[model samples]
Target: MRGTVAHLVPVADPDEVATIIAASKRAVGAAVESLHFPLVPGVAAAIAETDNAWRALEAEHGLLDAAAVSRMLGSRGRPGALANDRRSAGKLIGVRRRHQYLYPGFQFDAARGRTRPAIPALIAAADDAGLPHDELALWLCEPSGQLGGDRPVDRLDDADAVVTALSAHVGVQW
Candidate 1:
């Protein structure tokens, strides 16, 4: 990395300097992400199991890509309207899987093509609890003791129950 910087960046223009810094930071981040760390056999197996479980869950139900979500949302005049709305009010449950983020299909009412009413409060609670979105996605897919062994995704319509469960979680992984 020390030897990687062979070109001098323009320092006279603050904007140009900032752009260079931002690009370099992104490159560093990409480098870090691309690195392969040593993994114990046991840990590797556990990770594989977890990933398989998640894949099974995703396959059993369904995952909606952003385009699918936007399509279901119907073409509004504004691009990324669903994201904008969810950002402000937490109306959706989205999670990253692999290279792209996918939304849980159960989050929406299939008939109406709209987000389930109960999703907002639950998403908001999950956000408040600071649970990583990916964990939330996994949590929703798995059965919960709090819901009497029912998966949160299955009980998505029960806002009170889900929110209560989320509050009880207090940001801890489910």
Candidate 2:
């Protein structure tokens, strides 16, 4: 992606820039269109299976619904501040289930009295990879052989490792 963007950097001509921009837009459009193409019969089932596994994992780890999170954070009723943080700062990510959002409890950095600083970067990397919120949370909490069986959340102290792991998970160099 950087390589694609870098091709436009040296261009000083307005027309050339416009041409590059148009090409970029076309490329992005094709990518987006590809996502909507019909999946193989087993692919949708596989995704459903993966989601079920993640849900079981989430149950084991325990999750906090929006109201529960608001109560735990001592900011009951609407959780406007936390919601804002999720959108504006990427400090938190919520998975929607049954029309309500559920937050992962581990994301709250009790030791620091806030969400972990590295969370936003992780979220960004996952977003770039097109990972959904629930799957992202499950990925963070589950032990991975790639990290010597360490859950990604446990490596939050090392932001670089988390970023690398996220990039690797998404198969991007980042």
Return the TM-score for each candidate structure: 0.68, 0.59
Using lDDT as the measure, the top candidate is 1
**Candidate 1 ranges with C-alpha deviation above 4 Å:** 1-41, 77-89, 171-174
The sequence of per-residue lDDT tens digits that candidate 2 reaches over residues 81-138 is 5554564456677777667666776677655556677778888888888887677887
lDDT of each: 0.71, 0.69
The true-versus-predicted C-alpha distance at residue 66 of model 2, in Å, is: 2.0
Which pairs of residues have clashing backbones in candidate 2?
Answer: none
Task: Please give the lDDT score for candidate 1.
Answer: 0.71
Model 1 C-alpha lDDT per residue in residues 1-174, reported as the tens digit of each score: 234322244256767767886887786568556769743447644664577667766777688777767778774655556654563556777776777667777787867878888787877777777777667777877788888989888887888998787787664555
Looking at model 1, the pairs that clash are: none
